[model samples]
Target chain A: MRRSRTALFVLVLALAVAACGGTASLKGAVRNPPLEVGTLSLPGPDGREVTMKAEPGGLLLVYFGYTSCPDVCPTTMADISEALTELHPDQAEKVTVAMVTVDPERDTLERLDDYLGHFFSRRLPLRTEDFDRLSAVTAAFGVQWEIEEHEPGDQAYDVAHTALTYVVDDTGTVRVEWPFGFSSEDMAADLAALLEEPRA
Target chain B: MKRTSCRRRLAIASVLVVTLAACGGGSGGLEVTEAWARTSPAMAEAGAAYMQITNGGGADDALVGVSVDPAVARSAEIHETVMAEADDEATHGSDMGGGMMEMRAVDRLEIPAGETVSLEPGGYHIMLLDLASPLEEGSTVELTLTFENAGELVVTAEVRATGP
Candidate 1:
């Protein structure tokens, strides 16, 4: 009976270790396991195909916005730029910031390039081939966007999109998501912590 | 003797008060402060300006219209960026799922008596549309804001690369 009880205790200890090793908890970040976003191929600012995969051995920071965004989009980009600036040069290089435009009709490749150039250099301006493709890619990350039309005679319109910044690990699993008003310091700290985690 | 000195002191104090009032006091007048605009890319067709307007007098004021140089833009108007209600199903873990964001033109923005109206990002702003040329950073644009009670106030807005 004593030997059986000892064996059961050892089994419980082993199970607990396995469970703890399966997931890594990040500060100020939501742990989302099994969140897989497969490889994405989109047009880069250079008009060439840019395929984004998790095997690149760096974290991917993806944000969705348009070039004509007068406020939130620019603010978020600036925040990301500042956050990257706070990181060490090598650590900053380990992270990639990709901005996917929802307003494909208005945000041409050249225009997207111009807008992103104002904030940071090491970034990707992902342009959609078409509306359908854009929808498919955004749906994979649970992003939602809509184009709000103006009055019947007016020619102006606005694209309303989700403003969250998704952080995906090197293995294609989403690890953290920063909401609209998240600070640069928090993002920098989170990225640093994620960088320290051992690769799976 | 003491009474005479007190009278002189009162006279000097009254003069100082009058001078200070003349320098800054505007009863019921609209004051514009911290006016600024974000720089637009060379190909951008529109830009936005933000500012704070305060009514210093006892009466309320309304921002009626905004006018800029014809060379800067074809027209300028007041616009409010609001987040409209989003679909229930789409609201799951979505930052913007709570509302559908949109910018709409408004006729006027009201400033209550002795109250301040802030025109900032994700809120009220002056939309400069049909830009003749892109607004460059480090440049300043002249804006003419017409108020219902404060008349027209001309303010120079510095073009910035980022929002506050």
Candidate 2:
């Protein structure tokens, strides 16, 4: 069963790459299955074990990047913030942005906290302990991470992963993930449409 | 005498047109307005600032550089976010980048007139290098934006409090 699942993941990953302009492959490869968003236990930047569950009552936007990421991570979130500004203050309430770290090795609770601070004044930190854990969760949603190469035993790296930001609907299903470089207007429109999805 | 007078007027008119065109967006003649800046915390070795670059006057204006309290930071520069890639097109990180995927600059940071320029995290931003001291929240830092032609405009950046 595991071999078949791995083969399927490989196939999907190949296709995903094709659809993604044949960008670089995702590191810490996982089984790219549709994520079943639900309660999961993970340590947050606060160092406390945080049990986060999917609330179908609202829309969640998720991304996987490390804190030290020079640009891609921050730029993507900043874009999301801009799109949020376009949303009605009331409707914005129904949206939550979740960024999980791939470099949990260095993204200590303190580091994660500091990293998230640049994005959301109130954004809580999301961190994982093991690569396998991150791999499993990210794979479940087809999130890829291919950390760039460097020196031997070196931790610092530049990563190339799926640039698409994930938008999970209230039902815990991966909804549409707006590709990188979506205009602010288009992002707002898609988000509004998703927000108005018959509130489950 | 008449010919010389006409040439002088034409030169003056040309200068005016060029200046006016630049006073807005690019030479493209876009209207610009609603410019604001966020102040970095003073005393901090480094800080960041943000603003809204509305192009009500033009199509778009690209922010290339900034000048701030030299006393506050050794240098102020513009930064655009981008993902790294390798020459073989693999992800470059701690182990890769045999000069492979170099971190490329963002195509452009568009400042559309009337739209707020949110240079927050995960977006276009100004990096303040070498701060004089730590910037405190609620404090304001004076920022001067030198545009291509619209000239230079100084703004106050408001520092917000956050966990260190």
User: What TM-score does chain A reach in every model?
Assistant: 0.81, 0.71
Candidate 1 wrongly placed segments (more than 4 Å): A1-34, A45-55, A149-155, A198-200, B1-28, B87-99
Q: Summarize candidate 2's per-residue lDDT along A50-160 as a digit string, tens digits.
A: 444445466677777765554455556667777778899877777777778776665676666665565555355677777667666665555556665577666545455
Scored by lDDT, the top model is 1
Q: Taking the tens digit of each residue's C-alpha lDDT, what string does model 1 give over A1-200?
A: 99999999999987875565433454444643445765766788657776554436688888888887766676678678888989998888888788898877778877887877777777788987587777767767777787665666454677777877888776666777787757889889888877765554
Once fitted onto the true fold, the runs of candidate 2 whose alpha carbons sit more than 4 angstroms away are A1-41, A45-53, A146-159, B1-164
Q: In model 1, what are the clashing residue pairs, if there are any?
A: B28-B57, B84-B100
